[model samples]
Target: MSDLEKKVKQFIDRHKLIQKGSSVLVGVSGGPDSLALLYFLNKHKEMYDITLTVAHVDHMLRGKQSFEELLYVKNICKDWDIPFEGVQVNVNEISKESSSSIEVIAREVRYDFFQSVMKKRNISTLALGHHGDDQIETILMRLTRGSELKAAAGIQVKRPFATGTIIRPFLCVTKSEIEDYIKMNNLIPVYDHTNEEDIYTRNRYRNHILPFLKSENKNVHIHFQQFSEQMLEDEFFLMDLAKKTYNKVVSKEKNGDLTLNLIEFRKAPFPLQRRCIQLILNYLYNGELPKDLTSIHIDSIFELIDKTKPSGQIDLPQNLKVYRSYDLCVFTFHVQTKKPYFLNWDKGKTLELPNGRQLFMKEGSVPDDIGQNIFILDENTEFPLYVRTRKNGDRIRIKGVGTKKIKSLFIDLKIPHNERDVWPIVTDQEDNILWVPGLRKSIYEASDFTTGEKVILQYK
Candidate 1:
């Protein structure tokens, strides 16, 4: 067996990439790497007890040339007696319509075609020809672009796709090894001229960075592959830990809001803290992170938590809000401005406030003690009291503090920004602010409990 073949076989075995009697669908682009992988898999099909089917995509970028490349792959499949599937996607048109780059659209359509073929053939394994050099370039590119932790680990050798698994067996071999194999087999492979151009980021990395790294160390690809594998393994273990810690420290509400316990989260290790934040974001975004959500947002969350102030908030992509109030951090998509509400309090009836609190006014003798939530009014006081949300320029008279604006009271009490809008405020018939429920009572509250009949206003 050739050294490249031996290396790939060992990699597949070590990773448990394929099972015996598996139906494998190979993605071929008529390139040297993919052509070599197809030849190697076809040569050892009987030994591995696997069936082979070829899937090709014509990302109609080069017009006729791209279609011809697809035909070449189909012809090769026919010569090898392997089943063939091909697709044509106008990647340029799709890119324009989707506002995505040509390379991203092409990759999306190619993978979509590959998965369709796998599902049609009931294939359990889908193999791609991503060599070791590709792994190095992917890691470097992601790091340069400030990708998140898991993304910086680079392309996984094996991951779940559709109803089966996608495997990259050639990740153990370098690009030069694939070229050598193609030459030894006298194979003719079509080249994409775009790959040689420096317009694309990956091509620039391939043209310059790769040669420099390889010159310093001939086996640099091997070291990079090992680094990728190690990173993936560590990420897997840490993510598991983070998930468990998340369950302990994060609470998901019925309305899809997330409440994180900063105390318990801060107790966790630093790595797990970052991962827990990632878990929260993943849950909030339904596992589909927005493209613009980079590590900077995650750092912002950390900064919010570490700040000495007890309360702050930061807006994230997609209208999400991260609020830190005291030891509690909340992640929510609901940032609707609370509508100002004003409701008249009918005698002997309960009024429900917008913040889910109940307020009632009843005629009775004053209790011996008045709490912050209860306000006693004399019979001669203002009639037709009202309960409403705070309005601009709202103020109340305190016993010792004199007049204080409602906004200043909320700030002094360290109320969360979102809650300050909906906090219930009590007013008399003349629009005079009387009491801030669960907070302060205005000086208008009847201090002489012994006088005549009394009106008791209590908040629940």
Candidate 2:
């Protein structure tokens, strides 16, 4: 057996990615990596007791070159007596419609097409040609971009796909090894010109970063791949513990909100806490992590949990909010456009805000121990109190200071851009801003508080 075949077999046996008598669908892009996978799998099909089928996706970004590559894959499959399936998609249009990058949309389309072919062919596994070098690139990318232990685990060897499994048999091999195998077999593999361009992040890593790293350490690829393997094992163990902790401490509400028991959640280690947060988010999001939830978000959650305050809230990606109310920490998915909210609050009544928070008004004295949730204003200031979201040109005057724009205050507080629009702004009947929730109180009329009548605003 050839070295490529031996490595492929060893990888399959080690990962148990393929079963005997299983039908496999190979993604063939006509590039060296994929072509090599197709060739090797076909050569060893009988030995593995498998049948081979090839799937190709034409991204339509390269004009005629796209069709040429599709023909190349089709003819090669014909030559090898393997079934060929190809689909055409306008990746540019899809990218624009989905607001995603061309590379991301193209990969999505490719995988969707591959799964459709797999279903039609009754294939139990779809094999891709991601090798050790690709794994190194993925790890370095996530590392430079700030990743957690699970993200550092890099590309998995085998993951569940549409109806079967997606396997990467060449992850144990390198690009040079695959090239050597192709040369030994006198194979002609097409090259993708786009890959040679360093515009893309992966290409930059492949063309520039990997070379520089190799100069310092000759075995950098192997070392990084080994590191990924080690990290993956650690990730799995932590995830298992997190899953158990999630079942114990997490409760789903009738309205799809997830509440984590703070008593139990705070007792867990920091690592499990992070994973538990991620696991709950994935569960609430239908088994997928929100793309915007980062390590920073997770760390911020830990910080919030450690705080001595009775109630606090933090904004997360995808309009999700993690808030501590009394003894429970809740994760709420609020995906709605911010609309101007105007409500009138009578003394001793509760006013609802646009974000589902309530502000209770009561006739009381200004207590010396008033906390952040309490706002004291003159009761005779206005008859009907008003509450609304921020609007353009909204300015508030500080005590003994000039008027400042609410936007500037938000910038000073380091409020994220997405949360600023929906942040509640409390105003009087005359439209004088009184308080900004979770932020500063107006203090605009501090001198006017000499009156005996005062109304206390408490947030709930």
Candidate 3:
């Protein structure tokens, strides 16, 4: 076997990228790297006991040139007697119709096509041609763009995709090695001119940063691949720990709010704490993190937990609210500002509030024991009672203690800021605040032995 073949064979065996009798689909772009990968896989197909199929995407960015590359790959597959699958997509037009760039749209289209083909053919593996140099570029680019450590780990060699797994057998070899292989095999691979331009970030790293690094260390790509593998391993272990820690310290409410126990969260190491926050954000965002979410937002959460103040809040992108009350911190996508509403209550009727709560009013004998969620009013207390949200400068008269601001009451009760606006406030026709449901009641609460009929208000 040739040196290149031996190296790739060892790498694949080490990673267990392909199983015996596996059906492998190769993504061929008619470039040196991909073409080399295709040739290598086909040459060793029988030895590995695997079936090979070639898949190509004509991005239609360069008009006829792109289509010709697709044709070249298809013809090569025909000559080798390998099954071929190809698609033509107007990526430029798609980009124009959406907010995504051409590069982003092209990658999405290519991957979607590859996944569809894999699913249809029941393929067990999709092999790609990303090389060691590509790994180095991806790492540097992500780090330069302020990516977190997990993201900086860069492209993975093997990961789960559509119906099976996507494997990168070329990651063990450098771009120069792939070029050398192509030349030795007498293969004619079409090149994309755009790859030579510096306008793209990856090209910039490849054209300028890569040569400098290679000059410093002839085998830098190997060290980078080692670094990437190590980082991924470490990240995987830490993230597993973080997920366990999260399950222990966080509880999900029925309303889709996440309540984390700060006391328990702080018991973990700093690394786990950071990852727990990331896990929370990922869960809350349903795995698609907002672009604006960064380390700064995470740091603010840590600050909120560490602060001496018992209650505080910070707003995040996409209407996410993170707040702390006592030892509990909540992450929710609920709206912070509730609309102010004034709802009138009729006797023996339930009024549905905008905040998904019900307020019921009735005339009956006052109970000796009244809970925070229940209020009793004097029989002569005025008609047309109202249940509305708190207004500015709203205060309730507390027996013997005089009047207190609703805002102060909320603060004293440690109510979350987002909930205070929607808290039900019971009042009389004269606009006299009677009670704050599930909280405090006013001085007008009647006694059980009162001579007249009493009004009972219950909030649920």
lDDT of each: 0.88, 0.81, 0.88
Residue 15 lDDT in candidate 1:
95
Q: Each model's number of backbone clashes?
A: 0, 0, 0
Residue 211 of model 2 has an lDDT of 81
lDDT of 3 by residue, 1-460 (tens): 7777788999999989889999999999999988899999999888889999989999999989899999999999999999999999999889888987898899999999999999899997999999999999999999999876778998888998976999999898888888888889999999889899988888999999999999999799889999999999999999999999999999998779999998899999999998898899889999888889887888898899999988898989998988888888989887655788888777787887776678888777777777898887776777678888988899999988899999999888878776788888888888988888888888887755466666688888
Better of 1 and 2 by TM-score: 1
* TM-score of each model, in listed order: 0.82, 0.71, 0.86
1-460: candidate 2 lDDT, tens digit per residue: 8877787788789889888998999998898899988888888788889998899999999999989989989999889999899999999887777867788889889988997888787888999999988998999898888766777679888888997899999998888889999899888988888788988888999998878887898767667777877888888999999988898899987658888888898788878888888787677767666667677887788777778875678988777888775457778885544666667776678876666577887775677766657788754576677777788999987766668899989877755454566788888877888888667777743445455767777886
Candidate 1's C-alpha runs over 4 A off are 286-294, 336-340, 345-385, 390-415, 425-460
- Models ranked on TM-score: 3, 1, 2
The true-versus-predicted C-alpha distance at residue 380 of model 2, in Å, is 38
Error of 2 at 259 (Å): 1.5
Ten residues in a row with the worst lDDT in model 2? Answer: 444-453
Which is superior by TM-score, 2 or 3?
3
List clashing residue pairs in candidate 1.
Answer: none
- Ordering by lDDT: 3, 1, 2
TM-score of candidate 3 on Cα atoms, chains taken together: 0.86
Clashing pairs in 2: none
The alpha-carbon deviation from the true structure for residue 253 of candidate 3, after best TM-score superposition, in angstroms, is 5.2
* Candidate 1: tens digits of C-alpha lDDT, residues 187-235: 9999888889998999999999999999999899889888888998999
Candidate 3 — which residues are off by over 4 angstroms?
Answer: 250-259, 284-286, 318-321, 324-335, 338-341, 361-384, 390-409, 427-435, 440-458
